[model samples]
Target: MNAIVIGAGVVGLAVARALAMAGHDTFILDGEPAFGTWTSARNSEVIHAGIYYPQGSLKARLCVVGKEMLYAYCATRDVPHSNCKKLIFAADASQSPKLDGILASALGAGVTDLVRLSANEVRKIEPALRCEEALLSPSTGIIDSHAFMMALLADAEAHGAQLVCNTKVTRVVRKNGQWAIYVDGSAEVAATADIVINSGGLAAQNIAANTEGLDPATVPPLYLARGVYFSYSSVLPFHHLIYPIPEQGGLGTHLTLDLAGRSRFGPDVEWISEIDYRVDPSRHAKFVAGARQIWADIDPTKLRPAFAGIRPKLSGPGEPAADFAVLGPADHGSPGLVCLFGIESPGLTASLAIADLVLHKVATD
Candidate 1:
């Protein structure tokens, strides 16, 4: 079987790897000069333990299964990662009930390793933290996402998959029981394959809209939610990833340490009209305020503007969070094609599971 996967992000690479491993000739295309340079690299790199998502949703299911798969893959493949754990805390006694609700939700999502901690227990583990209560997720961790993607690409190439960077798939037309892919405004078809998976991250909807046989109504509107990161100038006193309660459009401003132990606070949700990666210097004060909720002794002067990332969301502000949309031929009545949309948070962690699902859907549908 010949397969072509659009978008060279982590999810796309994973799908390509799976298809190639299944003995299909696979090719990966990306508009950027390299793969995994967009949303895949811009996230907190935290391996979520399936908490905070609605039970039975794709986010919950894929994240739970994918977290385990990711950990195992990293261990065997020598990919740099850490199961350093995470703490979701409540600032005051009045907010402690939220911890119960979170714990219940996590349990429903098959995350049973969460340990409820009182303020004193929290102080014992993290002396710098000032919280009324907390939930310690032992399964939560971080990964070197770039290394992970590089490994996936290597495996795919070893299995006869090819990656073409800067090759933007402008349109896909189903003809003669196959997909004719056009790239870079070329009038002629760039390639043809029996299976075409639209895994474009932020540009996914646009690619679907351009596909000839796909239904226009099936394409969901893309909402860009920009989250800015502010890196701490020095190492912090926290050993675990520190998070507050969930916020609208994202998890609260949390502190995540990279592999080198450099800490950063960030990703405050801001809805935007256009795609922009600029970190607003004025947001420093807002980040400081959010940081103080977790650490009272954090020095504001040490916080500096680091970077920002935009999430290609399906739902808008004030609306309920949307699930990951993996629309195959069964959903859209378009055979031999699968379009993935609203794949944002926990995407890096769930990349492998998502690839498995995509392969199964294309095969069965």
Candidate 2:
């Protein structure tokens, strides 16, 4: 089968690899010149353990599976990553039960290594920090997202898959048991054997709407939320990723480190209407206020607007967190077409798992 995966982000690249491994002639198409220049580039780079998600949710299932696969793949490909662990800190003493809930969620997701710590014990791990209670996650870690994407590309290419850059999939049409893909405003199209997985990320909603024969009802409404990240100019005191127990909508302001050991804080979730990457410098005050609850000594000068990422959040803020919605024949009524929506947060950690799920859908459909 000839499989065409639109979008070359982490999820798309991972899906390409999985499809090629499944004996399909796989090709990844991206409007961008390079892979992961969007959400995959601008993220916390933290590989979250399957915590904070409700039980039986897709985020819970895939992240738990994908985190394990990601670790193994990193080791195999010599990708730079760290199981440096995570600390879901109880910044507010009254919020201690939230931390307990996080532990329970992780356990329900099939992780059991979580250990509770008292305030002094939390200080034992990082004496410079202040916290009333915490849960230690040995499985949580960070990855060089670029290196990880490169590894996926390498594997996909080695297995006879190809990437088509600057090839924007303008429209898709299903005719006579095959998908005809039009790229870059050109009428010239490519025919696929059976499957056409639209892992278009931010542009997914738009892509499905423009497809010549695709039903609009099959594609869910896209909720674009811009998450802004900030960087600390100083040395990081904490060795592990410090996260607050997430609220219902998103993770609160937290500190994460890069492979270079610089501290970056991010993804303070802000709802937006469209794909906007503008980092509001004015939000620094709010970021500082939220971050100080975790790091009391946050220097205003060190906190600078670094980068921003727009999540394809299907759900809005202040609502119940939603599940990963990957529409296949079962949902879309299209036998060989797959559409993925609301693949946010653990999307990176769940990249491989999503890839496998997509491949299975392609195969079984």
Candidate 3:
């Protein structure tokens, strides 16, 4: 089968590798001059342990499976990553029961390595932390996402997949028996393929709306949520990733360290109406307050505006979070068309698993 995958993000690259490895001629297209420049580059880069997501959800199932696959892939490919572990904590007694709920959710998702810790117990390992209770996730860690994407692209190219950058897929129309893709709104068809997968991270909804033969009702509304990070200039006190209780749209402003051992506090979520990457320096006070909840000794002077990334969310404010939406040909009545939406957070970790799932769908359909 000849396949065309739109958007060369991590998930798209992984899917291309799978299609190519399965003896299909694969082509990857992206709007940017380089791949993995959007959501793939702007992230916390943490390898989640499948916690917090509701049990039986795609995020939970794939995250647990993808975490292990990613670790193994990193090892074999010599990609830089670490099992530095993580600590999800409750700042006071009122929030302690959330720890048990998180544990139950993790267990349901097949993550059984979480260990409950008391404040004193946590102090023994991380004296700088000031939490009432916490759950230690030994399997959680961080990864060099850029390197990981590079590896996937290398494997795809090695397996005869071609990648074309700076070509934005404007519309997809159903021809006689195949899909005709147009780029940059040009009247001429850019290419045609037997199978087409829409993995356009941020631009997915727009692409689906522009798809001629697809049902407009199947296109879910796109919600944008921007998250900003602040880098800590001084040395980090804690060894493991420190997280607070989950919030409505995201995990709270927690602390995470890069592979170089440098510290950063981040991802304060703010709902937005448009795409913007500008970091607000005024948010430094909010970051300081959030950081003080975990480590009281955090110096405000060291905190500086680092960067920001917007999430391509499906649900809006005050609504329950949505699961990963992988709409196949069977659901939308469009032959040989598969679309993925709301692939944020653990998408990097779940890249390989998502690819496998897409391949299985392609085979069965």
Predicted structure 3, TM vs. truth: 0.98
Model 3 misplacement above 4 A: none
lDDT (Cα, tens digit) per residue for candidate 3, span 96-214: 99898889988988899999999999999999998898999999999999999999999999999999999999999999899999998899999999999999989999999988889
lDDT of candidate 2 vs native? Answer: 0.86
Collision pairs in model 1: none
Give Cα distance to truth, residue 4, candidate 3, Å. Answer: 0.5
Q: TM-scores for all candidates?
A: 0.99, 0.96, 0.98
- Residue-wise C-alpha lDDT for candidate 1, range 1-365, written one tens digit per residue: 99999999999999999999999999999999999999998989999999988999999999999999999999999999999999999988888898889999999998999999988999999999998889999999999999999999999999999999999999899899999999999999999999999999999999999999799999999999998999999889999999998876578899999999999998888899988998879888999999998888889999999988889999998899999999998899998899999999989999999999999998897
Model 1, position 171, has a per-residue lDDT of 85
lDDT of 2 by residue, 183-219 (tens): 8888777555578889889998888887766777767
Query: Which of 1 and 3 is the better model by TM-score?
Result: 1
When 2 and 3 are scored with lDDT, the better candidate is 3
Reference-based lDDT, each prediction: 0.93, 0.86, 0.93
Off by over 4 Å in 1: none
